[model samples]
Target chain A: MSIEARFRIDRDDFTLDVDLTIPERGVTALFGPSGCGKTTLLRAIAGLEASQNGYLKVGDEIWQDEQKNLLPHQRPIGYVFQEPSLFAHLNVQRNLEYGLKRLRGVTPKVSLKHAVELLGIGHLLERKPHQLSGGEQQRVAIARALAVSPAMLLMDEPLAALDMIRKHEILPYLESLHRELDIPVLYVSHSREEVARLGDNLVLLEAGRVQAMGTVSELFSRLDLALAHGPETETVIKAVVAGYDEEFELSYLDFSGGRFAVAGKRLPLGSAARLQILARDISLTLEHQTKTSILNIFPATVDEMTYEGTAQITVKIKIGSVAVLVRITRKSASELGLQLGQAVYAQVKSVALLS
Target chain B: MFTEYDLAALWITLKLAVITTLILLLIGTPLAWWLARSRWRYKFLFEAVVALPLVLPPTVLGFYLLIALGPHGPIGGLMETLGGSPLAFTFTGLVIGSVFYSMPFVVQPLQGAFTAIGERPLEVAATLGASPIDRFFSVAVPLARPGFLTATVLGFAHTLGEFGVVLMIGGNIPGVTQVLSIAIYDHVEALEYTQAHWISGSLLLLSFLLLMSVYALNRRFSVVKP
Candidate 1:
């Protein structure tokens, strides 16, 4: 099943008009800068924005259409706002039960105990909201939403209100939730690192419009998209832990592109992991260098090339079935006479391991 | 030094304050919720009308209410047509006058409390499967507890001390319409200083205790909020 949404919202300064069909099982990120209407689109899908002429379908259920409009409470959706928004009058346990009590006769798919344990808030059940720190309060807010057993979850910049330290404190819980839950998630965020780490499908929004939509790996490496040429531009790759070299303390991850030797033995064999390879860390060579210290060297075919300003050039290359980006100086490109479809070797410096 | 009439007047005053406070809470809740949440451009006009009793002289409000409740006026005329006697100079007339007189005392505090809550809690409640009515009772009411205490005390105390409105609409009947304030007036007019001092002192003490409890309770409640 998939979610189909069509919304047209007109405001004084901006308008959001889009049609999207995203997968219903994994996290689909509405990625954009501030004021680009990513949050508005999420709110519209949740039935909070009151956008007219909108049509929304989650799985087989029609949440909104021309003839009928469900209110926010009527839609079976769990929403996490930018703030924790825990009820000040209630203790943490009562706050968690607030939604569970309203479920009427519907059988709860997510039990209250499971939500509490998932967020690691079991010890805070007796304390009031004022007693908890910012990160703890946000955890309670998330658990409260989950206790309702909603069909889908919508999060609007959930980490934007916290500092870097607090964000780190809560991200693990979020990652585990993504791993364990079957409910689909619509995550709205402007942070590129967050999108790269948590998102499975990416919906790129620009100026209140859908610029592009695809799997995270495809969009991140696409040369024409805005994600390709920036200093922070990186390609995401899905890999499986092949083996661990206990002597060198290295874990070998095999992807469609090639095998990567990363500096860790933490990942268990046969587990899945994500890798982020920055474009600047990669250098193109005409032949394999045997005298080099670099451990990762893979033969790739150049698929596309684009100039960055006057000095640097970004080249897209295909290694087996996966696409990766490599940035080299324009002088090097000209001296080597690099052209599209040319066979080359891509040298890697480092990679970030994401789970 | 208090007479039997003074005791009777005290009963009538307490009865009026209690009934008026209850009525104000029932109606003032929805009114204050609207004032706090509505984005209507002309809302200030309605707010100004609720606050008129605060600035206007009590006698001026009493005069208009006296006219409105009299036998020939609109409200009294409607009652007469419905086969009931006119409300002027009755205990019910005193109640109507007190509700109008003490409106701002109840509504302003409630509206301020509701506004201070912000919209985040209610929206969170909605996402958690609370209907509008359910949200009001479950979230809004509990969060606005301090406001409810303030509104109740202010409305009841303000009604107890009313003199001009009661004199005009209630006509100061001995056992029926005469309240503590009018009774104290009668004692002072007859040069009965002891009886007047006794009643006035009781009122002063009662109002002080009510106000003190609200401040004490409000501070405790404020600590629970972030």
Candidate 2:
């Protein structure tokens, strides 16, 4: 089961035309720059925007088409806006119940208690919306949406309105929601860090068009995509915790690429974790160095290379079945005689454990 | 110091204001909501009609209304065909007149309040499974409470001060069509200065209190976030 959507929306200044088939589970991020039709697509799917010749089907349910157009309230969806728009008249508990009370004949998939616990908003149930801080209000808003137990969750930059501190405050609850819920999520964001940390599938949009669509790793490291040539270019690795070195306080994560040693014992053995590797953090060598301070050294095959500006070059290398990127000066590329399909050693200097 | 005629006029004035306010709210809410949210290009024409009483002289409006509610007019002719008397000189006629006379007072504040709410809250409510009517009562109305209060007070107070419209249509029948303002006008015309002063002073005090309470409650409401 998947979500199939085709939308063409024309405004005075811009047009959004796209056809997409998104997976039914996990977080699929609509990643793009501002005014790139990311929010428009999400709203069209939620039946909030009227698009010309639109077609939308979530799993087996047909929400919109030539003959059928469901209203926003009629569709089984929970949408979290960029602003935490809680009702001023209702307290947190009543706001949460607002949706639940309107769920005509359909059994709620997420109970109010479960939603409150998930967002950690149990203490705020009695307080009105104005009494809560911005972050707390957003959490209550999230809980209020969850209490409806929608078939799919649509989030349009749920953290974009918050400051850095408040964003950090809410990210963990979002992560837990991703982990614990079975509902598919369409997360719209322009932040690369947010996409890397929370997204499983990526739909890259540019100028109201789909630039690329694939897994987060595939789209980030693809040489043909603009994401590979930027300063913030990075790749995400899904790995399992193989073991924990208690004495050294390091956790070994195993992926298709290789085993990564991260300085943390927080993740239990066999649990899944995500690792973020930056292109600037890796260097290419002609031979394996046994006398290096770096703990991770893997034999990689150079698959592709692209020049970055005038002085730097970005190279895509494959370690086992996984892909990684290395940035080197243009001068170093020629001196070392790098070529496609050439086997080399990739030395990593840093890796960020995303989750 | 108040006579039986003065008391009767006071009672009639209060009754007229209360009924007019209640009737205005019942009809004004949907009209204001539509005016605030509709995308029709011709909506301004309707808005201008609703606001006509604000700029037009009260006697002019009353002249047209008196024709409309009289025996020869379409509304009164239809009523007569349905085995009813013409509404020209009845309490119902004053109510209809006041509803028209004070429409802008009730609707403009409501339309402004509804517009200030923006689309986010209603969209949020709809996505959360609220139907159209449900969203109106649950979200829009509560959020626009200050507007409602202002509309109510202004509608009531403006109706209490009606004189020209009632004189044109109601004919100032004491203890029936005569209200406080009409009774004061009669006192002044008859050279009863003391009775006119009493009624005028009471009206000034009542209007002041009504307006003051609206401001106080609206301040309290504004303190709460939308």
What TM-score would every model get versus the actual structure?
A: 0.98, 0.98
Model 1 interface CAPRI class: high
Task: Report DockQ per prediction, comma-separated.
Answer: 0.87, 0.81
Q: Write the per-residue lDDT of candidate 2 for residues B1-226, one digit (tens) a residue.
A: 6789999989999999999999999999999999999999999999999999999999999899889889999888888999998999988899999999999999999999999999999999999999999999999999999999999999999999988898898888888889999888889999999999999999999999999999999999999864
Chain B alone, TM-score of each model? 0.99, 0.98
- For model 1, the local distance difference test gives 0.92
Q: State the lDDT of candidate 1 residue by residue for B16-135, as single tens digits.
A: 999999999999999999999999999999999999999988889888888888889899888899999889999999999999999999999999999999998998999888999999
lDDT of 1 by residue, A25-143 (tens): 87899998899999899989888897879999989989999998999898898999999999999999999999899888989999999999999999999999999999999999999
Quote the true-contact fraction of every model.
0.80, 0.80
Question: Runs in model 1 with CA error above 4 Å?
Answer: none
lDDT (10s digit) by residue, model 2, range A86-125: 9988999999999999999999989899999999999998
Runs with alpha carbons beyond 4 Å of true place in candidate 2? none
Minimum summed lDDT over a 10-residue window in model 1 chain B is located at: B62-71
